[model samples]
Target chain A: MKSRVWLRWFVVTIGLAAVIHVAVVWLVPVVIMRVFMSRVAAQYGVNRVITQPLPTDLSRTVVKPSPDLLYGVCVFDVSAGPVRLSIMPPTTYWSLSLFDTNTDNFFTFNANDLKVSTADLMLGSAGDSGDAAARFPSARFVVTPHNKGVMLARLLVLDKTNMDEALAAQKSIQCNAIKRGS
Target chain B: MMTWVAKAIGVLVVAAAIAIGSAWAVLLHYPLQTDIANGSWRTSLAVGSTSADPYTRARVALTGLFALNPSEAIYFSANVDNAGRPLRTHCTYVIDGKPFVAQWWSITAYADDNFLIPNPANRFSFNMGNVPTGTDGRYRIVASSAEQTGNWLPTGTGGRGLILTLRLYNASPEILRQLSSIELPSIKLAGSCP
Candidate 1:
C-alpha cells in the first residue's frame, strides 16, 4: 500500500510540474511585455512621440540598443479610440516598426515603402469599428492584435555631421489619440 | 496521518521548484528551437514574428524586445569566435568582412548582461558609414579592451563574456531568402590571452 501511494504521489508531482512549466513559459513573454509597456507609458505617456538621443553605455532604457541609430518611441493604447501616427521620413535609411502587446512586430515599413515624404497611419484594435477608416481616408488604417502596443521609429545617424538632421527628422514624428466622432 | 500530510506537502514543494527551475533554465540558457546557426553566429527568422513559438517569444521578450521583423532588419549574434571559443572581454578579436548586401549594417559588442560595455572612448559600435574600408572594399574592426589604432571597438575593462550583434537593415531579397547561406564576418582571436 505504501509503495502504491508513493507512486501515485510521484505521478501527481510530475503532472503538476508539467502544468507549472507550461504556464510559466507561456506567461513569461506576456508578463515581460506588460511590465515594459507599463514602464514606457509611465515615463513617456501613451499616444505621444518621444525622441531619444543616441544610445550609449549609459542608456539603460532598452537593452541592446544600437548606438548608430536614433530612436523615437510611442507607447499607444487604442482602448479609448484609435491612435494616429505621422512620420517625416529622413533622407537617410529610416524605418518605422509597430509591436503588439505580445512583442510581435506585426507591421513595419521603411523609407523605400513611402511614396511621399510623410506617412500618416492610424492604428486601431482588430475588433474596432471601421468607421475611422472612412473618417481618415488619407491615413492608412492598421489593425493591431492588441489594443496596447508600441510604435518605434529608427533613423540611422551615419556620422556626427548628420546627427542634427536625424534629430530634426525624429522630432517631427507625432502620435496622438483620435477623439471619437471628431 | 500527520506524516502522510507532511510528505505530500514536501512533494508539492519539490514539484513547484522543479517546474520553475526548468522553465527558467530553458528560457534563459537554452537556445531557441528555430535558431539558425552559421559559423559562430545564430539568428532566427521567427524573432519578433507573430508566428514564433512560445520559447522564442519569451526569449525575444527578455533579450531583444521590440526587435523589427526579419523583413525590416535581421539580427545576428555571436557569443563565440571562429575557432568555437567563447568571446571574452580580456581577449582581443578581429572581425573581417566585405560589404553586406543591405542598405545599412553595423556590429556592436555588448556584455553578457545585454548592455553596452562602458568604455572611456564612449565608442560602442562601428557601422558601414563610419568604418573605413580597404581598397578591396573589406573592413576590419579590432575589438579589444585596449584601444587600437584604426577601427577599434572598445570591449571595456570588465572581464566578462562578450556578445557581438550584427544588424543588417533593409537586406536584399536574396540575402533574406538565403539567410543561413549568406557570408558573414569572421571573428578571429588576435593574440594569446593572459
Candidate 2:
C-alpha cells in the first residue's frame, strides 16, 4: 500500500513539472509573440499587409501613437504646405521621406533635394525663430501643387534605440504652407 | 477495483492531451512560407539584398472593406527579361464567390525591386473599383506594359521582375476561413516590349 501511494505521488509530481516546463518554454514565447505582433501592428500603422485594403482618407492632422510605439507617420495633404521635419537629440538613423502622392516617388527632404548634413542644416537656419522659421533645409524649395495627393510620410526609428526621444520627436515634426504672397 | 483506477488514469490522460493539443495548434498555425520571386524584381526594395528574413506574409481574400498598411508593404525592383528586352505581361485571377458591398479592391503591380514602373499613362495598379468583372462575379487582373485596358495592371516598360499585391477589405469570416480554397492569379508572358 505504501509503495503504491509513493508511486502515484511521483507520477503526479512529474506530470505537473512537465506541464510547468512546457508553459515556460512554449506558452511564454507564444504570449510574447502575440504581444510583439500587436506592438508592431500599432508601430507600423499598416492595417493588414497581405489581406486588407488601405484606407483612402489621409485627413488626420497627426499620427495618433501608442505608448510603446517606435514610429509615427501620416500622409498629409500636399496642399497643406512644405512638410516641417524636426529631430530631437541622441536618437540615430531617423528620417522623413516624401513621396509623390500618386506615384510614390522621392520628392525631397530637410530643405534639400537629398539628405543634407544635419550640421550644415543647423548653420543655414541659425538664429531663426522656432515658429515661422524653415524647419528643414528643403524649406527654401517651392511646394508646387500636384493633381494627385501625396501618399504617406514615413518616419523610421532605427532599432527603436531611443524610443522615448523618438516618441517626443515624432510630436515635434510639423508642417505648414508658406504664407500667402510671402 | 481495478476499473476505478483505470477510469481515473483515463480522465487524467485525456485532460493532459487537450491542454497540450490546444497549445500546439496556437503556436504553429499561421504564416507558412514566403517565396521571393528571386531576380524577378528589377530594383532593390531595401537598402541591400532582395530576400529578407523575419518577413511578414499574408493570405487574404480581397472582398469587402479590407485595407493595407502602406508602411509595411515594401516595393520590389522591376527587372527586364534575360534577352535585354522588356517582358511581355499577361495575367489572370479568379474570385470563387460573390462579394456583397465591395467598395473596391486592387492588385498593384510592382517590379521585383519594389518601385513603380515608369510609364507615360501613369498607370500602376488595377482595381475592382474601376476594372470590369465577369457576369458571374469572377475577376481577372492583367499586368503588362503593352497598354491593354480593362484590368490591366501596368508593368514597368521593361519586362523583368513582377510582384502583384491583391488587397481586400471588410471580408466576411467565411471567406477568411476558406482562404486555402481560394485560387491564386496566373500569369503568362505573351510578348516583350520593343
Candidate 3:
C-alpha cells in the first residue's frame, strides 16, 4: 500500500511541475506586452507615435535601454484592420521593427532595406493582406499572429548636438489606421 | 486518513519546488548560455527562436522584445575581461575587434542596470558604419573614463562596472552556421590602475 502511494505521488508531482513550467513560459510574453502596451497607450493615445529622447537615468519606465539611441514607439492594434506606417529616416543609421505580443520580431527593416526617403508598410494581424496591401505594392507587408503589439523605430544619435534634429525627424514618422480607397 | 494527507502534501511541495526552481534559474540568468570563440563571448542560441524552449522564450520575452532570430541577428554579452576578472570602471579596456561577417554590427555599453551610462561626451556605441578601422583592417576601441583619439567609447562616471553588448545584424551564412569556430573580438584590460 505504501509503495502504491509513493508511485502516485511521484507521477502527480512530475505532472504538476510540467504544467506550471509550460504555462509560465507561454504566458509571460503576452502578459508583459499587455502591460507595456497599456502604459504606452495611457501615456500617448493608441495608434499615435511617442517620440522619446535618450534616457538620462534608470528612473525611466523603459527597461535596459541604450541611451544614445533616440526611440519612437507605437502600440499597434490591428484588430480593427491593417495599420499603415510611414517612416522618413534621418540621414543616419536607423531601423524600424515590428514585434508581436509574444515578443518575436516577425518583421524588421532597416534604412538599407529601403532606398526612398519616405517608406510605407502595412502592419496587420495574421490573415488577409487587405486592400491596403494592393494599394501599396511597393510597400512591404508585415503580418503578426497576435492582434496588438509594439512598433519601435530606433535612430542612432551619434552625439548630443543632433537631439533636436532627431526629434524633428521622429515627429514626421506616422502610424495610422489604414483608410483604403476601394 | 492521516497517512494519505501527508503524502498529498509532500507531492505538492515537491511539485512547486521543481517547477519554480527550474524556471527561476533558466529564465532569469540564461544558465544555458553558450560560450563561443575561445570563451571570449557568450550568447544563448535559443533566444528569439520559434523553437526555443519555454524557459528561453520567457527569458527573451521578458528582457528583450522584438529581438531577431539568430538567422537575422545574434547578440553576445561579456561582463569580464579576457583574464577572467570582473570589468571595472577604474580600469580601462581595449576592445580589439575583427569584424564578424555581417551586413552590419555594433557594440554598445550599458550600465549595471542595463541602461546607457550618461556621460558628457554623449557617446554610447560604435558601429560598422562609423567605427574607424586600423592599418590591418581590425579596429581597437578604447573604453575609458578619459577621452582618447581615434576610436573612443566613454564609460561615463562609475562606468567601470559595465556590461558590453555586441550585436551582429543580418549576419552572414558562415557565422550563422558555424559561430563557435569563427574568431570574434577580444576584450583586454588596458593601462595600470591606481
TM-score, per-candidate, Cα-based: 0.95, 0.32, 0.79
TM-score of chain B in each prediction? 0.94, 0.47, 0.80
CAPRI-style grade of the A/B interface in model 1:
medium
lDDT of 2 by residue, A4-109 (tens): 9767856775575457445533444234333434454465432212111111112122111111223433333323233333344223323343332222233323
- Where does model 2 exceed 4 Å of error? A1-72, A75-182, B1-103, B188-194
Candidate 3 residue-wise lDDT, A1-182, digit = tens: 98997787788899998887677677887788788899888988778888876756552466556555678889888878778788777776567778767776667777767867777888875564756567778777888667787888877666656667777778877899774454
The better candidate by TM-score, 2 or 3, is 3
Residues A1-182 of candidate 1: C-alpha lDDT, one tens digit per residue: 98998899999999999998888878888898888778878887899888878999888867899999999999999989999988788788887789987888999977777877788888887554477777988777899888888899999998998888889889989899998678
Runs with alpha carbons beyond 4 Å of true place in candidate 1: A1-4, A126-129, B1-5
Please give the distance, in angstroms, between residue B124's alpha carbon in candidate 3 and its true position after superposition: 3.9
Error of 2 at B139 (Å): 3.3
TM-score of chain A of each: 0.91, 0.37, 0.86
Error of 3 at B99 (Å): 4.5
lDDT of 2 by residue, B1-194 (tens): 89869856765675466556544443223222442332322211221111221112111110100112222222222223333233333322221223333223345555544344556666555544445568867666556655665655565454465555443333345534433343333344454333
For model 3 chain B, where is the 10-residue window of minimal lDDT? B29-38
User: What tens-digit string does per-residue lDDT give for candidate 1 at B1-194?
Assistant: 99989988988798889999998898777777789888988899999888988888878877888888788889999999999999999899999999898999999999988989999999999998999999988999999999899999999996899999999988999988887888899999998876
Residue B80 lDDT, candidate 1, scale 0-100: 93
